[model samples]
Target: MAMSRNEILDQVKEVLVDALGLDEDEVTEGATLMGDLGAESIDFLDIVFRLEKTFGIKVPREELFPAESLMNNPDFVSGGKLTPKGLAEFKARMPHSDFSKFEANPDINKLTDLFTVAAVVNFVERKLNQAA
Candidate 1:
């Protein structure tokens, strides 16, 4: 079965905490990985890699770094400063699907978790399959 949004978020947080050596309590749904977690550009990439590994998702570069969108988000100030509200807003803006049922015609909000997990898993599976 696929995971819920909350479940994915929790797992993301856990992977972040472990990879970044941060306190679990500090990594909340409203915490910005770059702002609150002091993640530099390279660190951010590391986080992304960890996220992909943990969640089995392959986040697109455009989704990861949308220059225009990032500039508009409140969490990112002139110098990439993130506030708690910004983090919350960022999380709220993430693409989410229900991941409960498989469907040919999916409602925007009713997408199965497999879709989300597949982003990462497919990448790994493809690579591994090719290797074999």
Candidate 2:
């Protein structure tokens, strides 16, 4: 049985609540895992693991959170912001994420802001749909 988007969001909220020790209220759809929920890099690994378990689906770390790879690569980032090519690549990689705000700044530091609860739901929704 395929889960609805709301169902996926609920489960994702649970996963984040447990993984980050956050209050359920803090896991709203627009909340960024890092900035809003105070999730560190290590928490992302646990969140991915929990999501995989909850959905019985694979959640590739790189696919969901590709910041590390882009950060270290000079070609992908320059001058503390994403290069034009990097921005394109980011948009491609995180299609589940909303880039309307980030596209304006393209600051590498704000990359984590893209990792919102809604983005996680979208990723899971895509994964489950793909499996179906």
lDDT score for candidate 1 against the true structure: 0.48
CA deviation > 4 Å runs, candidate 2: none
Candidate 2 residue lDDT tens string, 93-119: 999999999999998889989999999
- Count backbone clashes in candidate 2: 0
Candidate 1's residue-wise lDDT over 1-132, tens digit each?
545555655676676677778888887654444556665566657766886677556655445443336446544432444344543443344433222342332222221122232232333344334344
Q: State every prediction's TM-score relative to the real structure.
A: 0.49, 0.96
Which candidate number maximizes TM-score?
A: 2
Cα deviation of 120, candidate 2, in Å:
0.5
